[model samples]
Target: MKWTYTIQTEGLTVEQLLRDEWRLSKKQVHELRMAKGILDADETPIRWNEPLAAGTPVVIQLADTVSPHVPEPNPDVSIVFEDDHLLIACKPKGMPTHPNDPGQSGTLLNGVLGYVHAHGGTYAEHVHRLDQGTSGLVLFAKHPVVKNALDRMLEDRQITREYLAEVEGNIQKNGGTITAPIGRDRHHPTRRHISPSGQPAITHYSVTARRKGTTELRLTLDTGRTHQIRVHLASIGHPITGDELYGGAADSAGTYKLHAFRMTFIHPFTGKKLTAQN
Candidate 1:
């Protein structure tokens, strides 16, 4: 894979661009250096420690490797946003974000791999994931550097993800935050619950609308624990409608009413604020 960027800041060294700006891993930087991947516009290798002036074009080339996901194209997979560095795709409900095992087909990642291949690209990877019962926009990285950067951004809470859900009961408060720890439920496999000895989880929610027996909510998270939103809402006695596992009423479709409605973050390379909505 090869990408080119024009130096925007004066006197920026390749080392700074890779380590400070892009946040590439030390191993990745060393590999790039060993491969002579950093080059000038003329395709000649450049000194990593040498400072380059503004407007200087730099090219990066890396060994091409195809994604491991088995491509199974599905029309349901929708690409909402795409660039050389990143992609935002809408994941349909009832599909796992990625395969649980190698060579698994029919997953969202497989479909994304199919899309990438169709576009003549050799690499694609999901940065985060959505629950199988929920539908939402998922972010993907087109390269390793951006993937590492996005992973760090998510860990630092620099990326904002907003969710919408219909719960079983009306909430009196206009807005509130849930600050509970979440851990695995010992009684049930694949279930999470609030526990005193668990990882800290925080969710902020506001009432959006009230129906006859359900309430719509807009929620944001400060931490992404497994089933954090579901566990938090259930703990407050407002289990999400159609969330049968959480003691809420069942849906006709047999899936929960949760949706990742929006995501906002700064582009790793372009430094532009970008938003994607489902």
Candidate 2:
């Protein structure tokens, strides 16, 4: 199976990719390079000196014969918030929250791994996820109790996530709800699009800013779904800027303009109203 992952550390280079960031020693990085374990997204071989900023998406091939293919590695991340129990970092556009494929690494998960290992930290589980193109505050649970509690909170809608986005065309509504259902785009299993036969998903949005040729909206979710904001906005004829998957073309800035911006939830342990904003 083909799997894709995104880099989540800022100014990360190829050398750092195989060694330092991945917790691989210099010798180990050399070994992977020799074994053809890495490749750029375009399947080109990138030298160990190549530099990829945080949020770059990297694809690793694991099943095919290991010959010679160095996939893409792009790492970019700017933290907006953090705590002992969680990290609400501001993810750049084009970075996946985790790796869904088998037998490989290099993701937000990998970056977290490097961070933890370097500092003698703990493993954190993402209570939620963001699409490769969406940028926002991600809820990461550091400890076990925090993870379980946040998971429960998410299931119960105790967390309020607010995102900022500039979508195609002008949005007329101050606020509205998207109650469409989503499922695997059977035509493209690796991709997701809205389908009537899909599960019910509800998204709420309020117009935050608008101008000619674009509308900026504040998005909040009552339910989480794959491509929730992107699909929902596109379904309403306002695809996120630079998101060609739904409607807009890829942008030169190379980062999705969306920002998680805000989230409100109760502390998993303290029961205090927890809010993080960027």
Candidate 3:
């Protein structure tokens, strides 16, 4: 994969440009140096100590081999949106966002890296994360500046996220807001629960459909937290179907019925509104 960057300021060397301006890790810099992927705009070879001036463009090409941390890319991963700056993909159920163990593989990140490699992109920078069982849209930033900008937008809640979920039992209210504090479960290391000392979480939901034993809901989050929706819904006696970890009833579908259905946000680079859905 090849990436091009135009030098905006003067007096920076090639090495400084890669490390400070572009935010490439030391390992990546060393690899690029070894591969001689760093070159002038004219495609001429350049040394690490070469001085760069304003308007000079430098290109960095990534090696074809997949990173050791990620598994081989699988082409079957679904693509929802793609542009020069962003990639939105629908993560399949049962795929973790990233590998969590030494021998772990087959994660969404691995698949994304594979796609990027195949398509001539440089890297995968995730804007947000989803649980393993939740099938939904996942955003990937193509560069560092875009990733940084989106991170700020997420921190300010400028990104709008909508989800669809099927929960056990009928809800008494057609629409309501759930304000609760969520924190890590003291007993179970990987679970979350409501607690007084936890971070504040707010969920707004409207009943959309009713199955024989479950109600489908359109849910919006005011604050994103680990297991916020599951914990809040279970606290209100409507845990998601098939989510036994949170005391939910078994689902006939054999999979947790939750999907990140929609995301709307302003484009950081183009200053235009964008919406992506599953």
The best candidate by TM-score is: 1
- Per-residue lDDT of candidate 3, residues 64-142 (tens digit): 4434455457765788888877889888888888777765668887788778878775577678989888989988877
Q: Which ten residues in a row have the lowest lDDT in candidate 1?
A: 64-73
lDDT of 1 by residue, 82-122 (tens): 99888999998899999999988888899998999898887
Candidate 3: residue 32 Cα off by (Å): 18
Q: In angstroms, how far off is 179's CA in candidate 2?
A: 1.6
What is the Å distance of residue 143 in model 2 from its true position? 2.0
| Model 2 deviation from native, Cα RMSD in Å | 16.8
* TM-score ranking of the models: 1, 3, 2
Tally clashes: model 1.
Answer: 0
Residue ranges of candidate 3 with Cα displaced over 4 Å: 1-68
Provide TM-scores for the models. 0.97, 0.68, 0.76
Candidate 2 lDDT by residue in tens digits, 72-183: 2334555556765577766666667776775345556556545544544546567888777676678776554345557767877889998889887887778899889978
Q: List the global CA lDDT of all models.
A: 0.91, 0.68, 0.81
Ranking by lDDT, best first? 1, 3, 2
